[model samples]
Target: MSINYLVLVAYLVVTFLVCGIPFGKIIARARGVDIQKVGSGNIGTTNVAREIGKGAAALTLLLDAGKGALATGLALWFFPAFITGGVSVAPHGDAAGLEGLVTLAAICGHIFSPFLHFHGGKGIAVGVGTLLGFAWPVGLMELAIFLVIAVASKRVSAGSVTVAAILGPVFALIYGPNLGLDLLLELAGLVVVWAHRSNIKKLINGQEKEFSFHKRGDKPEPDDDTIGESK
Candidate 1:
């Protein structure tokens, strides 16, 4: 095989391995807890914050986001030579089609982690990181939107879903149309939304739980009737 193809394969392997490391599990182990058995049975930052300490949750978010950023950065370094000459460039932009593919792969690895029995986090943190890889403006705007909605609704799921729902259009408007990036973001957003399907049902039934920053031990468990209502 050609060197470019070899590099591409190597990139995919490394990105998947790095992104699928399951930082939540590592943090939970350090705290003597199994994150997968905790709130929402998710390994995402929100669940970590609910079950473990906020410090652990913050660390997990940063690590997960870092995975995406690192993967995309590597792709940008190695994949530029692979971009076809005929590919359309966004205004004043270089070839980033491969970056989109790398971002998608990183997000997929986080969401469907091979190390976690193919079940993983909701991908919000990594998605933000991937956008950051694309451009600081895109990442900052999405992060701002997420913060606003999350604070207003008091639900991380709500903020996550809302930002994901609008990511494609917003990216298109801000960065100009790059069909590869647009399609990748659309797929990534849908996957994120699907990951929160249970949360959506809870919201529709007026039963979704608001986020709490308190440590898990600080709060008593909700009764069975209220269980499974929080993420």
Candidate 2:
């Protein structure tokens, strides 16, 4: 398969820009709140939920996830993959690798967004959305693992890292022997785990705060343990 370098680069750049949008920060700004100065100072869903209201957080999540899904869907549409009766997928060599790279670009856009001067969110929602757009079964798998761990431990980062690290095997199982594409997708997951490094450390040290919703009245929860913690 001959590669279209020009089109590939253009697609990646577009995906990066689109997925890089900091909806969390934008929503906060609309509500007269600076998400960057609140909670963990991250322009992600967690920070929005913790600092702003649930409505704003939901909007941010929806937008962030939408961009990622759109990017991934475009990739699969452009670099069509080989599916066996809509059950199993086989690699299309160059096209498969390109699809993985495109999906990776989507997550990278959120983690190191050019719009935010290379600073951005932890990439959880976008990563899931990207995978969901790529292979919904795999996406659901990751989402299930994330929800289980998150709910069990009350720490979102734990769920994020677990899903990110496990994608290698997940791809290996579902994508067959497409080592190159599998590895490429694993790179996408690695970028997500990298974004959650601080949270990883906090978790290891038992200092990570549990995911909690802020009051709608804009008042802090009296028992909010995250009030003093910077995370």
Top model by lDDT, which number? 2
Those runs of model 1 whose alpha carbons end farther than 4 Å from true positions after fitting are 81-95, 216-231
lDDT digits (tens) for residues 67-183 of candidate 2: 888887777666444332343222434446766777789888888878878888888898888778877888898889999999999988899899998886886776565777788
Report how far residue 85 has shifted in candidate 1, in Å: 5.3
- Please report the candidate that would top TM-score against the real structure: 1
Model 1, total clashes:
0
Per-residue alpha-carbon lDDT of candidate 1 for residues 163-225, written as tens digits (9 for 90 to 100) = 888877888888788777777777888888887888888899888889986454564232233
| Whole-model Cα lDDT of every candidate shown, in order | 0.77, 0.78
| Weakest lDDT window of 10 consecutive positions for candidate 2 | 222-231
Model 2 off-target regions past 4 Å? 1-3, 80-94, 219-231
